[model samples]
Target chain A: MEIYRYSMYPLGLKKLIVPCRQLQAFLQDLLESTDHLKAVLVTDKDGVILAKATGPDLPDHVLEPAFSATFSVASDQSGKLGFGRNKMIMSTFDEDQVVQFNYSPLILTLLASSKANSGVLIAAGKDLEEPIKIVGESVSKAIQHEHKAKEYV
Target chain B: MLKPKVITQVLQQANTAGVHAALLLNPDGSLVSFAGGTEKDAKVLAAVASNVWFGYERYGKPPAANSVEGGEGKEGLRNLILDCEQGKLSITRTSRMLLCLVADERVEWGLLKAKTRTLKEYLEGPLNLVASY
Candidate 1:
């Protein structure tokens, strides 16, 4: 429900600035496009909430950033064993609530009911990968821009 | 000591379904049993997994640690799955124990994950693993 805004560099590759407005619009489209997703939270490597969209029955407390941060550590380690970098983490909690996470230039936390189709949830996460990259880069740019402005003042 | 044969059977069963390796660990990360990997590999898996379980239990809050007294099963973490470029890993837990499965990239994960409860039962029953870690 609460969305955090940040400017992260995309995969730490190309440096580009994506406007915060664009990020919000992308989140909106993702929500409308996916019927099964109950909520989505975007966070940085530190597990700080950047931007999020929530549906019914979701509150801030349930969308903890600390849990999301651990995935990043797992992701980094996975790449070391000659395996590719980690793409996502899926956890099924009690009563069939399923949570899926994707780590990268951005970390995505998704929640859905136990009855929701697993395929649909996975596809939805894949669909948002690009948009999240751009949004993440936008956050980095925002922070950098703020720092620059401070220097001039 | 837990029966090695039953633990081996469970690991082999998991391997049949494509979980290349599996292990049981105490909350502190000591190796209880392992299936499908070299001894060195098993040690690596145990070391990393116990740390993960410990961190999650100690710091992952609101839902808090599942081991916390009176915490509902649904309140905290139940299972965790990760898909990396090369392979996949899944970790499930009890109050005092952890089950980690390390599988190859081609594994049929959904089927394997669906059977985690049965594996946990194997640990608790014939394997005689203590649940109070």
Candidate 2:
């Protein structure tokens, strides 16, 4: 089974692959160290999935839109309810299941089981704050590069 | 204590900072006060409130049903604050009214939040008091 699943992108987004790969590596390490069973990086604002890491139980396509919709809801709630700009959202469906997002241009989302350490997972998600910021900036740069390249072509 | 003054202040702060638009809506989502840098139709405010209410009905309630397990108080309230760049809209809630701030791509959310925080505190206190009388 494919552990990672993604859709084809136009050449404009092809430039983002390098940074996306780096983000995938960082997320893989983060997920492996913690008990986070699934991880996805989505483009902030747009809700496009850039990369993901999941176990065999979950498929990439299934998780991609799930992350996008969750982020969309969170972002929507933040806008309508007055939570300020949504910097992060951590929600527990039950004692065993939790979903989290750190909002940069790239959002780091995690799914963890009940046995996982909630506090640790929260902190680990927060820990990715800087890296996520870096990833967003790099992706923005890549997009710019792609745009410029297109202009030349 | 004057409603117009408060509305002016909210709009001015939002405008000076280059925000797109800011307005105050009643709990039911009627436009009680408004200040927009650009002209907007009165119908837009009503539509926004209706949209928020629709969202509240959809995703805002079910989570509360499970609130007895420590899930209720603010989850619904939090859901009311929704953002949609696709829609070019942002809204915040207070005890008495929903504050809707609309902007295009140029708005900086950080600054908008700070301004809204100030406004929220002000509205909750003196503004609420005025509304009561």
> Which prediction has the highest TM-score against the true structure?
1
lDDT of 1 by residue, A46-98 (tens): 77766777765555555653766766676666555445667776766553444
Candidate 2 Cα deviation (angstroms), residue B132:
32
Candidate 2 ranges with C-alpha deviation above 4 Å: A1-16, A40-44, A80-83, A94-98, A149-153, B1-133
Stretches of model 1 off by over 4 angstroms after superposition? A1-19, A32-36, A77-82, A96-103, A140-153, B58-74, B127-133
The DockQ value obtained for model 1 is 0.45
TM-scores for every predicted model? 0.76, 0.46
Which candidate achieves the best DockQ against the true structure?
1
- Clashes (N, CA, C under 3 Å) per candidate: 11, 20
- Listed for every candidate in order, the interface RMSD values in angstroms are 4.2, 9.1
